[model samples]
Target: MELIQNTPELSAYLAASDVIDHEHPLVRTVAATLRADASDAYTYAKAAFEFVRDTIPHSHDIGDPRVTWRASDVLEQGTGICYAKAHALVALLRAEGIPAGLCYQKFDVVHGLIAVRLPGEERWARQDPRGNKVDVDAQFRIDREQLAFLIRPEFNEVDWPVLFAEPHPAVLQCLQEAVDEPHLWQTLPTEL
Candidate 1:
């Protein structure tokens, strides 16, 4: 599917927001550590993706009750759901001046991921940083997407094509209102 940018300005994807919050010191520090190990933007992007995917345990996966909405909180506490992970990944990518945006998939409920326009690439590649499980092996590849869950059309799951500059209001609203992970899951929007 062709990705559509919500904002015409490419810079919007790179800009810091209250949620993406790339300018946060903790985000900067983590980005610095990842950047130091990476030789180029691609390596850095891959490294960043791997760092979040491998290091931070998906809150639901670990059954952590906390709910984190901001990118810095996700990085600092090392636990978050798919939307929070996507926020953390986007913050890391934008922290390094690489363009990044939020994307989503709809299953029984909404699932979140990120779309990155790598250096010099006009096309946006969506990557799922949702922590892997027994059958879900998400990878950082632009050529062919390595997302966590494949859309099962028969089940009515959909891949939303719009690449958002910030978290969708429906998502952000629920995340913000949720008191804990279980409450968050119960309240998750079924559609974008």
Candidate 2:
């Protein structure tokens, strides 16, 4: 499989050592596995996303900040906040040929999720652990009553804010800026 060039957000992420050396064996292992399995980028990306979503338990409470985490951290502890989990997925997807990025939403609290908006696709997909294949796209976001049609009971219980059809304006701006400044991850605020 050919390695697709990193999206601006992904490129910035890889330039940061803290993210690349995120303290978790699973993160490194997953990244390595994706790199090795170059045949099918989409399959590798989806599998990696599923691994993080299903294997790591979600924590409602915000924990200590002193604990710097990577994908490996969540994999080892079997739990993680949404941001870390999304970060891990991003690392793995980028290691492969897939183009992936992070999408931050204001959910009472700021939360981030992994997003893979494949080129030429109108909708973005989200990974649901309890769902059929564990990889679901936003195009499946149905009306309130229609939720049952798209998600399983286990996934329905979690509060998933509606995904925006278009990327947030601020996020788009940041991504544009990143194209010029590849190392912008270090200077930008973590909110987005």
Candidate 3:
């Protein structure tokens, strides 16, 4: 399916999610500012990714119950654990026409981050919310060859089994649902 890029549609979707609030101001702001650029999808995705990575701090203790904190919270506070930041990134990228999705791996302290694959891209790379850099060639152990095209030389391979031995069942379920139903999340208007 084609990714949604227009502001009204994207904003409506995000507002409905209720994930973007005053706390997560950056997500909303970025979406509004970048929507006017008219740049290619990848460029918008990269810019949004970098902005989130630089803005939020990496922490393992921020989100309680591991799911309550949404992108809005992270954007407003300027600090979030990995999962919250990833959610914000996902919302922003999808608003700009990039085909971004969530992928799950078992991790001990940190929650799974966002993974975005551009159209016609062969590999899926992990998005580091702390660094704001895409590890194009990094391995998460699902399959190297399948992700070879997504690998980035700058990022060290992520050890899947060691990082996430027993993935959270709820998180895995959410990731699956998100990938399966790409259009469920909505974005709101800038005025709202």
Judging by lDDT against the true structure, name the best candidate: 1
Task: Decide which is better by TM-score, 1 or 2.
Answer: 1
Alpha-carbon shift of residue 23 in model 2 (angstroms): 10
Instruction: Kindly list the per-residue Cα lDDT of model 2 for residues 12-123, writing each as its tens digit.
Output: 4333234433334556676676557544555566567657666655543333222223555555666545555665666666555445555544423344564554445444
Return whichever of 2 and 3 wins on TM-score.
3
The deviation in Å at residue 120 for candidate 1 is: 1.5
Pairs of colliding residues, candidate 2: 24-72, 27-72, 125-137
lDDT of each: 0.95, 0.45, 0.46
Number of the top TM-score candidate = 1
Per-candidate TM-score against the hidden true structure: 0.99, 0.49, 0.50
Give the C-alpha lDDT of model 2: 0.45
lDDT of 1 at 182: 94
lDDT against true structure, model 1: 0.95
lDDT of 3 by residue, 110-134 (tens): 2455556565665454565544335
Looking at model 1, which ten-residue stretch has the lowest summed lDDT? 141-150
